[model samples]
Target: MTGSPWYRDGRMRYGVGIEDTFIPQERIGHRKLDEYELTQHYARWEADLELVAESGAEFLRWGIPWYLVEPAPGRFDWSWTDRVAAKMQELGLRCIVDLMHYGTPLWLENSFLNAGYPERVAAYGRAVAERYRHVWTDFTPLNEPVVNAEWCGLTGSWPPYLVGDDGFVTVMMQLARGMVRTQQEIAAANPAAVFVHVDAGFRYEGETSPVPRAFLDERRFVGLDLITGRVQTSSVLGEWLASHGVTAAELQWFRDNAVKPDVIGVNYYPGFTTARIEDGVMTPVRSDAAGLRDLVELYSARYGGVLAITETSLVGTPEEKIAWLRDSTAELTALRDEGHDIVGYTWFPFFTLVDWLYRYDQKQPDEWFREFGLVDLVRGADQGLERVRNSAFPAFRELAIRDR
Candidate 1:
């Protein structure tokens, strides 16, 4: 919190995050999948912050539900977030605030496709920056653009449900524009704000054809490339974007106002980050520390900036989780030794999270919960999810203490 910004402090910071997905169910006809509400975080946030500090972590990756804070256009409420920000300061936790995490206020019809999305989201970002400029300095304008486009656009699982290539391109363009505007507004409000553009690090292995392996690989960088002005009409991905209706004017717009991230945070899960294709059926293959190394190398070679493992965890037994933590951290250490600007690592969720499928399924939240945190969530007599420490908690704490 002193001299040159946390990233330039010459120390590897460790952090933990509570799952804060706030996708409203107004358009889907189901209960909202608010992680904080389902995990009782709204009531027990103080205790949750205590848990984060107890983990020997100096940083916390947290989020604000823009939909809740700005329930109606031009109206703002900071009562809840005000207290949360104060507590993080009191705990001495450096926060990487997620400004938009895949949801919009109900008033904005058609979700991301709303014609007013870019400016509206930018205004929200400016408001948040003005309010919390003194307490927080880092922000993720939007988390995982590819995943956002995948769920809401390509798969038609969420709002404005469009499908296929056109939908993906449409959603990506909107997200890219909104993200650029958000960064610009935040910087105008707080000059010291640091942007950590986080995205899911995806890997695919298989035959090249209908969707060539090279195209799939290049597509992974489209989210970052578009925001940083690396996409042009001459590039393979840019050409694909053009075929899907992206105008040359739009590409030029990105090039004119590119906002590069101070830190490129890549979220990867050994169990879910990689996929193998055979006969055109994509199947997820379990990855190892080597897989993470490949991604870190890939990002470092392409983006060439300070990097962080923004999110990593496994939905398995405590022993399995501990093994992953050990292996992945070791790989990171080696990367650091090799001169990669690896600044931080985060064990996301902090506790269990209700899987996204819960939105479409008719099952109790407990049944849909995934155990991928330092602590496990269990239903108590009062039916509230209780955070019970698992073996990985101590293992992670020891690692954090040693690394820090």
Candidate 2:
């Protein structure tokens, strides 16, 4: 198969996000929510890669499971990663390696809150980059830093589950530092590497008062702002960080050692992007082309870099997903025609995923899979998993053929 080249080659990219999240929870008795297990990516990785290529996607948003990579501090395991990277190269599939998804290795107690979190994560990143330096050229140091901070720090969802604004500030600062250091180490290892900084893009509307609305709007920019060194000492976020325990000197460190991304990646889920706070109840506003267009415009103006829809999918029937694929492509093409450097559009999760609720160990039903993939996961006659083609497959394949 003659697949498309990676984004750094100046070609527009169409990709799929392989679901890779490893979060060890103390609440569920220290049971980890491993997406690779839930999605059976371990046993079926090769077949999964075939599915991604068959679906016509040019790039893969995949990651090396961090827990397995650095099981113990300084102990590195490259067997699994070595095999996967070799296969991806042989298959002509460009990989946007997600260096850290959402979890840390267990040996690193306190996770992101650890004082050495930045240095430790950067060490792991440097090892991977040096080892695979000649093979891969793109990476995402940490996925959704703000969301990770909120869940692990403010909401008490993961390890070192601290609850308070102080926890949030602490985790955010550590995450920012980790990102900066990780990029630095990787760049030192592979000077030609491209860093794609990805985060959840959102806009909020308060149905009642202006105070909360203004707060939420500013808060949305916390992760990106901190990473880009755009947060001023007197800014709303800086003040909040100062009151919560982040020193002025600490904030200055990030500003002084800023790492700009080669590409700005936006993960937009209509169900989460736009919301209304009516009578203090948050409701998902139906998705529209305007929201997607607005994001491309907003980010292009702010970051002034090539933009890619890193992740976008609707959880619904096959026809609905197909419709979304067509609509999203139109919006992206329109943006490109309007002179914006919109370079890519992705339909994430090349195959099905276990319900995200499974992360909380919420046992629902045997049929609880989230059907957002181009193909569905089904039980084979031997009771193992099988890829059952969904209606959206042809729709996406058509778009990929035309766009590619």
Candidate 3:
């Protein structure tokens, strides 16, 4: 804590998550998919910020659209983000700016596969940092890179959909490069800048036979390992990448320019975040405390950085969500007391968010709500989005104050 920023002081950093992810569609011909716009965040920015501040959380996992700001290459616009930066300062909410969530601008064809992707993303990160030099905005250059790669490269669910192991490695490398470059640029702009490397923390369990648990386990850490330069030529992941059509130069580049994270931000959720494979079928394992403790230990031993429960929320009723939040906080507090650098806890998505399955094709939920936020997104009689604070609000509000 001596040299680290004031925010990283050993005190637990409780925060509210602002769910903002934009995914482009290769299935639907290069169209943009924005969660913020779909969730009415653009229309209710001030209200949303107020809700986060009023929740008594110190940090907000915020995002701004790179495609909107950098409409075209070398041409930048800071109008929208300028206002956001000012408001965050006024509200006393420290932000962990998510520079690239999951998508790119329309101009960047093949998305993460594009050779210029790393440089382009780095440029945007640098521009944002320089523009907001006075504001103490921490950055998450890329969020959930492993999931981004798997969805875009392996499953053919997202843009530039490529269905193969080669595509997966390619996307992962591109993301790693972008993260490293973006960190470098942001740090150059402000030496005080800190980065919370956010990734989905998963634990895959199953029968020892039929499935190679070691392979899946090693693969889980590949994204973070590569970013931190842990993938040596003789390493299991490096060998796997070499066999999977990733060029020798690409592997060497990651080794040469790896960037370690300042904070290890683990995005944990209820279902499917921790899964078990029994007889080749995968299922969710429902023990938040056990999962959270294991993750804190794993990351603490492997990465040796200040850790954070960056995202955790349930989609059930308010009581159920509150129960999960309490359990999660207990685990995090236990870890912190045991001398682990577990610095923060976050209730992701302060309000209800629109479903990503529709990907902006449908305006709002027609049938029922996903209901993942502390507040519910209900359709009013006039058909506009209404923010209804659930029982979890007061509970989390009190918890945040007690933790501080």
Candidate 4:
């Protein structure tokens, strides 16, 4: 807290996730599998890492499909992560591996949401953290506890989707518990493993339906509170949590245990803004993008931890994206100046993703597929990579090199 970043910061570091930048998700249901397309996808990812390395960013966040790593119990093949991990090192950029992005590796049957899923995931996390002890240093054990719980558990939109405030608490508990223990297990083995806890950022109640807003606003974070070990006799949130799936006993466990994060990696997405409830539905309230900075500050205050925007992107022209980036950076700079331990910043995806709005329900290429990329997918191939020397690129460069 005395110095800048608390850990790492040179001109307020800049980085982004390599999702839309590289790689593609394998189809879940009856999606056709042409081996040729899949192989091509992997090859493109290798080149994409090279792009990430050359982007003048300090780090690149990538992930491995859990299904591939642990096909079943006791079986581990790291080929899925090996290529990316090795490539990241070869490029001389740090790797922040995303262990859990969406759900379980499918073979786990979405196990992290299960009762004992934490035990299983922790087992794997330890083995994995140890195995990659030499190369991968950072780990995002799970992504977006509140969002994942709501989407997968409350809405029943995702796999193993269940609907209820209680179900939300249970699933979120399994993830937070499993992820923390996994990091601990790794620390036990390697003694050098450090975890950067990643959380999604946004403040959205519902629009029309009282059902969504009711629980989302109040009961959404029972597990997060528990894992952070913040349960107390006088906690207003704690008592309400007890009435839901999270009970007094669970609160005790979280308060007594739960290792606080080394760096709380926040995935600051605009999508966290208002949804479901709209003008005529629930209320017309909407959280402005500028207000997002306030939310980040609030989280840092609530928990004595370092903060970083691990993800952010928008569907707009390159210039518009730059404006968004500039504004967000200014906000981050203010937060940093305000004495918050803000050490890292990211633009997210560096490229646009396909079918995300579809929820994997449809494979159609919507208008969004056009170009949300910092460097268009064809930047390297078509325009000698100079194609990307856009307005936003220089702002980041000026920042990284500025004498602040």
State model 3's lDDT.
Answer: 0.82
Better of 1 and 3 by lDDT: 1
Looking at model 1, the pairs that clash are: none
Q: Rank the candidates by lDDT, best first.
A: 1, 3, 2, 4
Best prediction by lDDT = 1
Off by over 4 Å in 4: 1-11, 20-41, 205-223, 271-289, 359-362, 365-370, 378-398, 401-404
> Predicted candidate 2: what Cα RMSD to the true structure?
2.8
- lDDT digits (tens) for residues 93-178 of candidate 2: 87889988888887887788788999999999999999987678889999888788878788777767878777877788888899
Candidate 2 ranges with C-alpha deviation above 4 Å: 1-11, 26-30, 208-211, 278-281, 362-367
Q: State the lDDT at 221 in candidate 4.
A: 48
| Model 4: pairs clashing at backbone N, Cα or C within 3 Å | 67-105, 207-277, 207-278, 207-282, 208-277, 208-281, 208-282
Residue 333 alpha-carbon offset, candidate 1, angstroms: 0.6
TM-score of 4: 0.83
TM-scores vs. true structure, each candidate: 0.97, 0.94, 0.94, 0.83
Question: After superposition, which runs of candidate 3 have C-alpha atoms over 4 Å from their true positions?
Answer: 1-4, 25-32, 208-211, 277-282, 360-368
Put down candidate 3 lDDT per residue, 276-384, tens digits, no spaces: 8767566787656788788888888888878888888878889998899888888887788898888888888777766666653544344425778887777779877
In candidate 3, residue 167 scores what lDDT?
A: 82
Residue 1's lDDT within candidate 2 is 11
- Candidate 1 stretches greater than 4 Å from native: 27-30, 278-280
Error of 4 at 347 (Å): 1.0
Q: Write the per-residue lDDT of candidate 4 for residues 280-315, one digit (tens) a residue.
A: 243324445666676677677778667778887765
Q: Give one clash count per candidate, in the order shown.
A: 0, 0, 0, 7
